[model samples]
Target: MVWGRKKKRGGRKEPVFGGVAASLAELRLNPLDRITVADDKPASRAAPRKAAGPGGDGSRERKPSQNRKGRKGRARKRTRGRLSRLFYWGAVLALWGGIAIVGVVVYVGAHLPPIQSLEIPKRPPTIKIVGADGSVLATRGEMAGSNVSLKDLPPYLPKAFIAIEDRRFYSHYGVDPIGILRAAVTNVLHMGVSQGGSTLTQQLAKNLFLTQERTLERKLQEVELALWLERKHTKAQILELYLNRVYFGSGAYGVEAAAQKYFGKPAKDVTLAEAAMLAGLVKSPSRLAPNRNPEGAEARAKVVLAAMADAHFITEQQARAATTRPSYAVKPVGAGTINYVADWVGEVLDDLVGQVDQNIVVETTIDPKLQSVAEAALIDELAAKSVKFNVSQGALVAMTPDGAIRAMVGGRNYGDSQFNRAVMAKRQPGSAFKPFVYLTAIEAGLTPETIRQDAPLDIKGWRPENYGHEYFGAVTLTQALAMSLNTVAVRLGLEVGPVNVVRTAHRLGITSKLEPNASIALGTSEVSPLELVGAYAPFANGGYAANPHIVDRIRTVDGNKLLYARAQAAPGRVIDPRSVAMMNTMMEQTLISGTARKAGIPGWTAAGKTGTSQDFRDAWFVGYTAKLVTGVWLGNDDNSPTRKATGGGLPVEVWTRFMRTAHEGMQPEPIPGTQRGGPLPDIAQLGRQVIAPAPAAPASVGGPPQPVRANVRPEAASGLDGWLVDRLFGGR
Candidate 1:
């Protein structure tokens, strides 16, 4: 507070503040320092203070030792220019990057389907074809067993998928940057693309809503959809959707289907090994399918097991045990011939229930027992005789007398060829077609006792010959049919008019087109084995026409809704009762003493006709009991000639094998019109052959309508036919 200067004469004594300013100016210090102190002076510029200022007090305002000019020489004035450094630009760049990210998100979001309207597509319907026994024979449709709930599946099954496909499946926000980085680094380390970054949720998005395109647009959409899914659905729900929608190999579309297809079990019953195997299939379904490549599937399964162990989903021992003995896919029981049935059912599903828009069950009429027998019969017989007889293919169709199909084997090996020979192939029936001609003749007032000469004769340019070109001069009508005498058949066809024979065939069941010519009796018309077998059904049912039918009733899978059912309306009578009886008698002789003796059903009454096509191109024997009518054909796909293989030979043998087992445990029903115990009353009226002392002469019989008589026993009379077959044809 002490004054530094005396007052001037004209001015009041200097104010204290003014003196302080003057003192500062005199000291060459800043005038502003009077109120605001300046920065501390540099130690090098401070002058040493006089010792305690003569009073030993140390507190003193030190003076500058260096001049202000000297201080100015050591420092520079501030300059103005750009203020930004690297850190400043870094902050600005970060803001722009955030905007770019937002813009990209919006662009991807724009392409997404409306979240409000987004919905899972409807699962395609599966058609399950069931056998007559109501057992599942095969499944036909887009998915084998598509819809399976996660709760229904074994815990290990889904865990196996989670371990191998998405390790952080529970934690990620759909798009896993950590996973992406890890995959990138792994790929870089391997110097190739080795790891995949897609989560299970991403895969499900691709399958459900996107085409399998690798374009950036699709990928971005997939990412956006995955994120949306994560937000909208619980982790478990998303996982379940993925499991139910993901593809498996071999036309299987989901874990349920894959489980049934490969392991022959439901997803819920899947073992640890099976779960691992199925999970491995998600990576490359086609390549890792067990059926296609068991080794690759097993190796991939081991990888899945290891992953499961690493994820702590399964114990190390369990994983090790699964890898030790790798799981194998089961060969489905409903393979081979069963698949043929499945295909046949598939072809008829539309007609039965209209378009197959929903899951349905087709209850077929196939007898599983007979089906196995028929397949085995055809395959075993062909395996033994196909090369020798030059017959490369064979088919069999068996049905109840009411026309419910019992068994159908379309080919020797269904895997080799899918062409359904039983229902699709049309081949000449040869003498197997004589029933129509005989039936027509019987309808025209001729009896089974009517005599017809077996002597060969030419009709126009066609001269039908018997198997050995030999003739039995005076054989009865029954004898002619039993012997399969082509000349007699032709003579009868001309006598009744081939057009009439064709009409008779059509009335019975044959749907194939027939040419009305003399050779029609010789079976020049091409007919599928199905048509031939169906036409023979009238005789087995005693006069009713039962068109061959495989589908008995069709309905929805739940069995609550009925789609179709065969009508209870009566089957129309195809053949006259008297004529039917007459035809049965004549055909029965064919089994007893005809070319088809080898095809006779042991301990049961059965009748069928055997035919050998010209050049032995086709051999057929269509036989029937009161219970069943079966037709078998042996030939080549190219219609190549067989090596003298006649209907009386391999065809007869095959028929015998199948019928023997088919008729097991069945009662021996007498052939209709034949003696059950006592001779049929009015044997003449019933059309039973009136075997008397000798063959009746035309004068005694008054042409042909009057019943004729013969002395020969049926057993003795049948010997001639069997002898001729064995001698002329290579018959068993």
Candidate 2:
């Protein structure tokens, strides 16, 4: 069909198509050329019959020796036009690198914080005290034992934390990309970051909404909140909200408080070698805490039991019998000073249910085996006699004669002083405050066998010496309060009126203020061993007034909701079942034969009062036992002075080794009203000394006994009818 005719011949003009006159090599050849009719010699001299070749039989004719293979076939078409412009700019830089990675995941998810109001953050409340027989003694806050479920644990403990934290955790969608290219080729062959592509749903989306700060916009808001917690939870509810919420060191926090703090059990009784040492404390939970690096938590629980036998979820003989028997966790029974009853239940937990937000359950009358025998009787008697009684510290409380505390240690190492020294150390309860100056002289009539003059004494000039300033002359106010005499407790605290011995020590529960000054009848007033064991629990519960409490109720850790309970106050009679049987027969003769016969409690007819203050500094004993009154104090948080240590020595040998382990199996009771004993047969006759009618110059419409000036001796201004006419007509 080629008929090109614009023929100029030699002037180089012979090509014409439909008007045919072609000759410039027949219009540069092949349009599938078979136009053999080119005999137009005169018109355009037909000489182009040899262009069609490949066997169309016009056979290879025109050849100026094939012009070097036509310049090497145009140099292979300019190398295929530079490989099609390098695949069109490599597909426009891979579509702008996938739109700059979706504009860096929408500018790190628009700086996060609003995935439909991302919830999951609550968790810090936890109170849980429990111990009046319901066990779990202490746990205050920051989660130590609750929220458990991934189907209540033990499917090899969340498959041993997804075989060392997410073996493609149920085939990842919460950002795994082949586990971040196998943890970036295993941290570039262990050059550093020792491997952690963060996929337990991106560590529960950076512990429930980011702050561990590594950055890159917190790893792109932890992969967009781990793909919005994998589209709002389910791979077993995000592996049970990432095994309850990860962190497992001592301050615990989930997986049932690190399986009840590393296997004191729960999480369905954890075993497989304590679930590979609590899934090897999810890597660095306080540096692999099996109670602080038990050999780096048994070498990270043998690398989580070889990643739970390489994720077959255990069995290379159960990961070599789970690292050949690895179960570590044992520290909970009164975990040292029961955190001093968890720091007095977090300082009375905002005054008994005022602000403690959520989780509660307090219930406390603490007898966790008498709080581990009052913290091993005050840390084994201050570690065997605290530098031989220079006594660094000590405290004990035990209660229940109506006060109900039942064991508190408070020091001698509540981890070297949480300073509760039995409810914050007021000290100087020396001469353990002569039982409220013999219970205000047996309610002002006087009877622990009357007789007083332990000879030498002084009032305004201060010579109250007795610990060997030697005097027992006519002693019988129960041997002058069993030889703690101090001038017969400054003459019965000046005949029952140092403001009636500070109102019988604040109606028998000494709420710490008591300084009615006859040197507070020798206790020199500084109270607190919980108000001297609730003012000696009314001489062991018979005339009641012990209000020393320690959370006896506070409810809601699912016991529905009570908030508080201890209000059953039947403790009315502050002292008078005959002055609580004559002050428990004069402090049971100072624990039978005075100065607390080393705080005796063999079969429990206990009665205490040792004390020792001023210059021998503070030391106390304060016993009780018509079912526990216990007090115990000791010395030195800089109130110094202890080497002569006495409250009859080491607080009566730590109240006779904590009332002989709190009267083991309890059944000896009698010191309450001692069956009409020691008080009225002229004060129970034992070495009879009834001289006490010495008082009376006390009455004045407001002005009298304030005139004592003798420095260290005699101030006997006899007025009660001249001391009952010299003790019933001179028998003295």
Candidate 3:
């Protein structure tokens, strides 16, 4: 219409170019433009196109070709819509999966301890047992050897563990992906879980923080902690921690302790063969220990050596040579007896320092040389006679006059029984307890010269008899004690009132309970060898109270703080000097002419008591010199009687054996209250030499008993018996 100048009729038609009042909208750039010339506005909605049919009826109609095209177009649109729906759901699933993954990560992280608070727990603190001269006797608590740094170990040692435990330990992160994959493949092929994929770091994480639980969650946590360890510590540090804290077996922990326990050497000194053996122990510590299963241990070590060779840590030739070398558990010297001392120290540890939170060093009073000597004496003597005597166990303890334990042999073989007989087993002292009774009597106005009947006597149906069942009609107090006449001891206990005897025993350091009765004088009451020896200490140390003690001082490993120390208080005087002199003078006769004659020391003045418990169930000898006190006991642990084994037999023999060696380097100190105290005279030099017999004396003797001394001048004696003792016996 515009082309036709629809307009010719448009009344004046808006002038050709729309002059004065015309709008710019009337302009059209092209024929397809919808701008109108008359109204100058955009057109309204278009009406549907209609096909003309049969004389302008304005009805719509379709052609066959158009219908076919429309059908194909609808099919194409349907296909495009299907593809869009597929893509939209796929994206939704992917987003949900991502969210799930984030949730799992957050959930696992929540189970962990705070990262800032993460810490490797301190291992059970090791208590080092040191001898008096500063040599390590043993470590009491956790390890035999002290802690050692990785740098101190031989390079091959750590490499051996690495070769067998984790081949790629140094190359990978804590959780090894390649190792895990290999293990997975292996497990799949076997159709079961046959191998573990834990790296050394992972194992450390499990040991330090996690329970030994097998679960999906725990494994994930382990992996996370391992990764943290890898980030926080160097590879070497992680390896060191793993090595030092891992258990090897046989009551040992740490490589250093393992080395000392199994090889009797330090980790730094272990050979290649030993290193391989130790490394193999990690796989099956209890089952593959060299001590328990040497064959298994050696076979595993061979595998480890082969692995080392394959890893280039060692040559094939070297590995083969190592296989030829023997690497087995070595038993430490005195393992049996020395452990008794260690156990005693362990019991005292808590008392000394509340709780052992850190490593500590305990300086004990044990003398290594003396300890060895004492053990040998007890063990060897028992070995020679136990079968013949029908005895199964024995114990011995040696101490200074001040009650410092120098040596302790708790049993014949600690491996067979860890029972500490020396400090724990309580048995009748028998006649050995008569000394306390006699000491009490001497304090109650009796003397070595005071006479008492040794005949059988009865007190409330309790009849006491002598060793041979033969009683002397009348014997001096010294004679009765030296002879260990049971009747005389009972009579004295009753005369002095058994309560006083009990008091004397307790005051002298007998910790065991005592029955204040007639039988108490015969040592019917039970007492430990430790207390017996400790009680005897007063007699040896000039009547001072001596409480038995083994520990000298306890301090931290670094020796900075003192946790416990033996107080240096002056000893309490438990007995007056007169009573001590009489007691010493009387008991010394037992070593010279009484029950313990065989237990004599050649160069020193010695005194002791021999005891044979009821039915010979227990035999004991508690002996002392001026400086040392030692006690020995032998019996069956079940309290069975022996084959007539008396205290004077095996116990005396063992005591003599130990005392002879103990006195070799010691200066001879005379018995107390002796004016001419010095080196004892050699008895062999005076064999059968005739001396004037002692003159029979008064029925009732008076005055202080003669002092037992060496090299006494005959004229210096106040009586004939004293002079004869000086000349013939050289002062007991």
Candidate number of the best lDDT: 3
The better-scoring model by TM-score among 2 and 3 is 3
Output the lDDT of residue 313, model 1.
97
TM-score of 2: 0.34
Ranking by lDDT: 3, 1, 2
The lDDT, on a scale of 0 to 1, for candidate 1 is 0.79
Most TM-score-accurate candidate: 1
Query: Which candidate do you rate higher for lDDT, 2 or 3?
Result: 3
lDDT of each: 0.79, 0.73, 0.81
lDDT of 3 by residue, 1-732 (tens): 345534345365333664643343334233333454533122223322454334553345557687668667766877899999999999999999999988877788799998779998888888889999999987766663566888899989999988988999989999889999999999999999977899999999887888888998888888889999999999989988988888898778889889988888888999999999999999988899888778888999999999999999999999989899765656533345888999999998778778888888999999999899999998888888899989989999999999999999999887788999999999998888988999988999988888765554444555555665444445678777776777677778877888999999999999899999868988889999999999999999888999888899999989889989888999889989888887888888788766777778887888989998999899999999987899999999999999978888899989999888988877999767643433233322222222222222222112322221122123322233434333322111
At residue 612, candidate 3 shows an lDDT of 87
Tens-digit lDDT string for candidate 2 (447-497)? 765665565544545565566544435556776676676766777777667
TM-score of each: 0.73, 0.34, 0.72
Model 3, which residues run further than 4 Å from truth?
Answer: 1-113, 122-124, 144-159, 167-198, 210-224, 227-236, 250-253, 256-271, 286-296, 309-316, 326-336, 557-563, 674-732
